[model samples]
Target: MLHLENLSFSVHNNGDSKQIISDINLDIKRGKLYGITGPNGGGKTTLAKVIMGILTHTAGHIYLDGEDISDKNITERANLGIAYAFQQPPRFKGLTVEDLVKIAQPKLSNLSVRKRMRDVGLCPEDYLDRDMGSGLSGGEMKRIEILQVLARNAKLAIFDEPEAGVDLWTIQRLVDIIVGKYQNNPEAAAVLITHNRNILPICDEIVVIEEGRIKHHGHRDEIWPIIRDDIVCQVQDTCRGEEII
Candidate 1:
């Protein structure tokens, strides 16, 4: 289990300190998926980075399975079975998909690599030898990055915007793979930060953050109705803008 006790973060913007995350408290248990969704600039990503130790919290404690990890660095946290997937995955000019996977888990075998590719809905022969560069589209790169995290077999995984820039079919496949693999592991947990409505359906619980505070959080069935209405409003606004253009 992962626990955040009154976690908070602040940063210097224009030489003035501004709080990005308020006194946020959350508990994440293994075998469950926790979805974080909200409008942009709501500190959702900041919270994930704090949990991953990418940014040191100004106050509060972070505990993993009863161990105090609040002061640990990003590498230390990763060594403790915590993994994070970036919103925009980085590209490696000379690295093949197989090579990257090997680096993630040196003990992974050729057969396992093929299986991982297939798990993410990619054909082994078609992607294993492909370079992790511009040749791969945003969606392909996201899937490959996810495959690397899966190979790590981390106890807790944080994925930021996993469905961004992907088509509906691809998003569906990715969400299924993520929820299936992560939620099925009795000793692992997943935290997904996304604005995609489709991904929310698979979550065990949803946390809605607004203006650096948690506006609402509860079981999927309980929270969906309120959030669904908000999402509908946003979509309608977007459509209106498109029509105007």
Candidate 2:
């Protein structure tokens, strides 16, 4: 399980301060898929980075499985079974897909690598031999990143917009891969940061963040109505004041 207690982070821009996250608190239970959605500039990505240790916190605490990991570095957190797939994946200049997977799972055989890629809706023969560099499309890079995470078998996986850049047909496949992975292990938990409503039904809980704080958190069914109503009202208001030519 993962817990954030009074977590806060800020940045100083030219002597002016801006808080990305403010006194946020939440608990994610084991084996559940948690979804985070909010408008842009709402600190959702910042929260994900804070949890993965990609960004240091200005204040508050992060605990993983009852142990405080607030001070741990990225490698330490990864070694502790935490994996994160960034919104924009980094490309290794010389590494091939097979090489990355091997690095993630040294003991994985060629058969296993193929299976993992297949699970993520990739063609193993074509992709495994390809270099994981600039040639691959964004969707491919995202899927490759996910393959590495799956290969690592991390207990807690944080995926930031896994569906981003992926085609609609592939998005369903990506969701299935995520669901299958977590369903395989009861103790494995996942945090899915996405804005697409298509994925909401697949999650156990949805945490709606706005302006650096958690605005709502509850079961998908319970939270969907409020979110839907708010979105509809906003759209209606925006369209009402527009004048026709």
User: What TM-score does candidate 1 reach?
Assistant: 0.90
lDDT by residue (145-242, candidate 1, tens digit) is: 88888889899999999888777777787788788888867999999999877788779999999998899999999998999998889888888847
TM-score of each: 0.90, 0.95
Report the poorest 10 consecutive residues by lDDT, candidate 1: 236-245
User: Candidate 2 on 1-245: residue-level lDDT in tens?
Assistant: 88899999999999999999999999988778998998888999999999989999999999999999999999999999999998999999899999999998899988988988888888987888888777999999999988888788899998999999988888898898888888436779888999887887678889999999999999989987788787788789989979989
Best by TM-score: 2
Q: What is candidate 2's local distance difference test score?
A: 0.89
Q: Give the range of the ten consecutive residues with the poorest summed lDDT in model 2.
A: 178-187
Q: Give each prediction's root-mean-square deviation over alpha carbons.
A: 2.4, 1.5
